[model samples]
Target chain A: MSLILAAESLAEIINSYAECDASSVAIAAVIHVALIGAFFGLPAGIFIWAERKVSARIQDRLGPTRVGGRFGWLQAVADGAKLVQKEDLCPKDADKPLFRIAPYVVVIASFAAFMFLPFTDGWSAVSLDVGMFLLFAMLSLEVIGVILAGYASGSKWALFGGMREAAQMVSYEIPMSICALIPIVMAGTLNLNEVIHYQSADWIGVIPPFLHWNVFHPVAGPAFIVYFVCATASCKRAPFDLAEAESELVAGFLTEYSGMRWSFFFLAEYASMFLVSAVAAILFLGGWDDGFGIVRALKGNSTNVLDPGVIAGNLLGAGVLMLKASKLVLIQIWVRWTLPRLRIDQVMTTCLKYLLPMSCALFLAAVVYPMALVLGTGRPQILPLSNDVSAEAEMSTSSEVEVERAAADGEVT
Target chain B: MTIDQYLFALFALLTCGGAISVVICQNVVRMAFSLIISLASISALFFLLSADFVGATQLMVYVGGTIVLLIFGVMLTSSSALLQIRTSPAEGFLAAGIGVLFLSVFSFTVWSVDWDRNEAKLAGVTAVDVPPQDYNEASSGNTVRPLAMSFVGLRPDKAGKAPGYLLPFEIVSVHLLVVLIGAAYLARTKRRVSAES
Candidate 1:
C-alpha cells in the first residue's frame, strides 16, 4: 500500500527533475534511506530515555537530572557521546571479526524490520504484502547476531547468555506467531493495513467502533494478552529476560560487550519492542484509526486534495498509532521494573507449555467463532454492522415521515 | 542502470559474497553468521522475484528458525577457543573447484531454458512491448489469500490446473508435531542417578 503511494510520490517528484531517470532514482533512494535512518535512530534514543525516566518514576527517583537541562532530556545523547569516546576493547581470546560485526548485524535486522511497519495508511517505507511475515523474519535474524556476539566474546557468561536467548527467542516465536494469527484469521488478510481496516467494522449492527477492535472480541481478547506476553519475552524484557539477567549471567549475551557495541544490543532490543507493539496495535487495536471516524471525516470525500485536514488527519493518525505503541512500550517498561526475571527453564515452560497451547486454542476458537456465528445467525459476518446501523436509521427516518403524513391528513380531515 | 537492476545487482552481490564468506570463514560461529547473510540475501532475491510470501517464509523458517537452532547446537557442543575448525588449503581448493563446477552446470541448465518466451506467452504478448494490463498479469497477485485458500483445499489461482495444499499442509503440521515431541523427548534430562544409589 505504502509502496504504491511512495512510487506515486517518487514519480511526481521525479517529473520535475527528469523522468524516472538515474538521478531521480538516486534522490528517491537517498531520501528513503534517510527516512529509515531517522525512524530507527530516533526511536532508539527516545525509548532509552523513556525507559530510564519510567523506571526512575516507578522507583520514586529522578533518572537523569544533569545532562541537558531540567528533566535531562538529552541524557541519551550524553550517554551516546560517552559511549563513542569509550575505548573499543577486545578480549585477547575473542573472535575479533565476528565480535566487531555482530552489533551491526543486529542493528541492520532491526532497521530492516522497521521498514515493513505502516505508521499510517499508505505510509510504510516498503509496504510489501507479507509485511508481518517479513517483520518476523527480519526480527528472527536478530537472534543470530546475539548468538554471534556471545560466541565471539570467548566468555562462558556470554556463551550462556547467547544460548539462553536463542532457546527463549525460538520458543517464544511459535506462540507469538500463533497468537498474531487470531486477528489475522478474523481480518481474513495478512496485510497489516487490511487487518486494522477489518477491526474498524462494527459488530451485530449495534457495537461501537471501539468495541469492534480485535482485543475486545471473545477469542482475540485472550490472544492479545498472549501476544503481548510472547512479545515481551521475545523482546527480552524483564521476567523472560534470562538472556541478560544481571544477577545471574552478568548481562547475558551482552556480558562482554562495552560502549557503543553494548548500546547497539539495547538499540536492537528497544527497536524490536516498538516493532512488536506497533504490530499488536495494527493487528488488534484500531491501528491508525482513532475509532470514532474522526480521521475519515478529516480526510473528507475528496480524492485529489492534499489539504490541511487530510494531512493533519494522517499526522494525527500516525501520532495515535505511535502513542498506542508507546503506551504498550511503557507497560513493558513498567512490567520490567515490577516483575522478577524468570529462570531459563521457567521461561521455556511459560512459552511452550502454557502460551503455545493457549495461542493454538485461541486460533482454533477464533476460527470456529465466525463460523458458529454464521451457523447461529445465518449472517456471513458480524461486521458491516455499521451498514446495518445506517439501514436501521434510514428505516426509522422513513417511519417518522409516514407518521408526519398521517398527522397532516388527520388535521385536514 | 534502472533502480531495479541496481537492487538486483546489490542483492546478488550480497548473496554470493555471503555464500563465499561462509565457506571461507573458519570459526563455526562466523560461518553461521555468514550463512545467515546468505539466507537473508536469498530472501531479498525472492522478494525481487516478487514471491513476497516465499521470501518471508524463507526468512522466517530458514534464516530465523533453523539458523538459530543450528547456532544453538554449535554453542552447546563446542568450546569457544576451539570453535575455529580450520581446513588445509589443498582441501579448500578442491572444494572450491567442485563448487565452481556445480555452479557452472547449474547456470548452464538455467540459461538453457527460454524464460523470456515463457513469460511473454504468459503475458499474451509478442515483441517486447507489454501493455500495462499485460505487465500486471506478468507479476503475480497478492499470494497471501491464494496461499491461505490453497491450504484450505481451494486453488483459485489456476483453478483446476493446480492441486490444493490442504492435505499436504495437514501432513506437514502433523509431522511437525511429531518432531516437536521427539525433540522434547531427546532434550529432556535423564533422571540423575540417585546420589544414594
Candidate 2:
C-alpha cells in the first residue's frame, strides 16, 4: 500500500515539476504501466519457483535444490535463461502471423485483469467502479488467444484441445460469475475496495469484525465453495485441466509452442492462478485485514504524515493480503497434485449440472437472507455504516485517533 | 495531442485496421480472429468514450461469446486445408464499391450533425462551461446501475420525455430464449448406422 502511495506521490511530483498538461498525464500513465509490469513480472517468476517447490513437497521429493544453493530459489531464473536460448519453432502448415501473435494476446489479457484488483485499501493500478466486471471481461479475452494458438498450430490435437478449452471455459464462466455476485450482493458495491471496507464492520452488530467476512454468512459460505471450484476451473487448473490433458492430447494446445512462446502461456497461467486467489481473498475472506484486528489497531493509531508507523502498517497490510492470497494459491497447487484430472465430459457436467444450479440457489438464498432478517428480526444481516466506506477511509487518513475513537464508541454502543 | 486523443487515435487505428483485415482475409478462421480484434478495439473505443460498462459488455458478449461461436462454426463445417474460401472478383469489386458508398454516406451524416450544440442545450450551458466530468472520469461510478434501472422501466437520468427500456429488455430476453432453443435443436447430433456396418 505504501508502494502505491509512493508511486502516486512520485507521479504528483513529476506533474508539479513538468507544469505541462498532457505530458504530465502521459508520464504518469507510463509510470503506472511500468509499475504494473514490474508487479506482474516479479510475481510470475516467484510463483513458478513456488509451484515447483510446493508440488515437489506434495509428491514427497526434493525440488530444484542445485541452482541457487540452499533452497534453489533461483530455479525459475535459470529456467528462464535456458528457455530464451532455445529456438522458436513454427510448423510448416501453421498460420505464421496468428501463431506468432497468440502468446502476446494471452499475456496481455492476463496482465490487464490485474489492473482492477486492489492489493490493499485504496491500492490498485486502476480502481474502476466496474472493477470485477472489467476483470472478468479481460479474463474472457484469454480464451481467444488459446483458441488462436490451437487453430494456428494446424495440428489435429491442438484443434481438439482448443475446442475443448473454449467449451469448458465458456460454460464455467456462468457459475463463476454467479458465485462472485453473491459477495457483491452482500457488500452492496461492485468496487472491490469498498467490499473490503464493508467487511471491516461487525456482523449484524453482534459478532466479531473478523467474522463479518461474507464467507461466514450462511449464503455466502456455500457461495465461497462454489466460487473456489469455479475459479479453479476458470484458471484451467486440475482436476479441470481438460484443455491440456498431457496424456491424451500431447500437451493439447501447447504441442506446437516452444521456447519463450510456450513459457508465455505458463506465465499467464500462473499469474491468473495468483490473480483468482487474490480475488477470492478479497471477496470471500477479509482483504488485507488481519482477522485478529492487530493491523487495524496499528492503522487506527498511525498518523498519515508518512511516518515510520504509518508506512510499517501499510506494508504490514499488504504483506497480510499477499500472504492470504498465497495460501490460497498453495492450496490450489496442493489440489492439483492430489486430485486426478477429470475427463472433458465430466468437467462440463460438473460445471453446468452441479455448480451452475448450486450457485443460483446460493444467490437466491443470499438475496433472501437479508429480507428474512429485516422481516423477522427487524435488522439487516450486515449493519449499515452511518458513514459511507469511502468517508470513513478519508477520516482514517486525516486523523487516525478520531477515527479510532469513533470506532471504539460505535463498537461499545 | 493529449493522452485521450492519442489513445483514441491508437484504438481507431486498431479498429479500422482489424475491420479491413476481416474483410480482405480469405481464411474463415483468420477473418474470425480479425473480427475479434475489431470487436476488442471497439470495446476500447467505448472505454475512451467513457462508457466502461458498455465496453466490458461488448468485450464479454461479442469478443468472447460470439466470436468463439463463429470460430466453432467455421471449424466444424470446414476442413483445415479448405478453411480459406476465395471470393469471386466480381463480388469483391461489388462489395468494395458498396462499402465505399456506405462509408461516404455515414461520414456525411455524422459531419452534418450539430452534436456539440445539442449537448450544450441538454446541459443548459455554453460549450466552454461544460464541466469535464464525463470527459475525465473514465471509471468513477458504477455505470451498470443506471443502465439496469433503465432496463427495469426507470429513466432517472433523463427527466423529460424519456423512454423506459422495460419492453425492449423483455423482448430481447424472450428473443434470446427462442435462439437458445433453436440453436440446441439445430446442433443436436444424429445417431449413425453403426449396426449396418
The best candidate by DockQ is: 2
For candidate 1, lDDT tens digit of each residue in A1-413?
12232344555677686765656756775677788788788877888998899899999998998888788899889888999888888888788998899899899988888877888866776665677777888888888888888888988899888888877888898899999888876665566776776665433445557777888888888899999999999998998889888888898878888888988888888888888999989988889878777776677655654778778878888998989998998899999999987888888888879999998888998888878988999864555554543335435645754554454345445
Considering every candidate listed, which one attains the maximal TM-score?
2
Regions of model 2 farther than 4 Å from truth: A1-13, A202-207, A301-310, A382-413, B116-142, B191-197
Q: Which ten residues in a row have the lowest lDDT in candidate 1 chain A?
A: A1-10
Q: State which docking tier applies to candidate 2.
A: acceptable
**Which parts of model 1 have CA positions greater than 4 angstroms off?**
A1-8, A201-207, A380-384, A388-413, B80-82, B86-90, B107-141, B183-197
TM-score of the A chain in model 2: 0.88
Q: List the residue pairs that clash in candidate 1.
A: none
- In candidate 2, which residue pairs clash? none
Query: On a 0 to 1 DockQ scale, where is model 1?
Result: 0.29
- Provide per-model DockQ scores: 0.29, 0.31
- What lDDT tens digits, residue by residue, belong to model 2 across residues B1-197? 65667778888999999999999999888899889988998988887776777888898889988998898899789986677768899999999999999999999999999999898787774222211122114233346655665787644344212566999999999999999999999899877699557
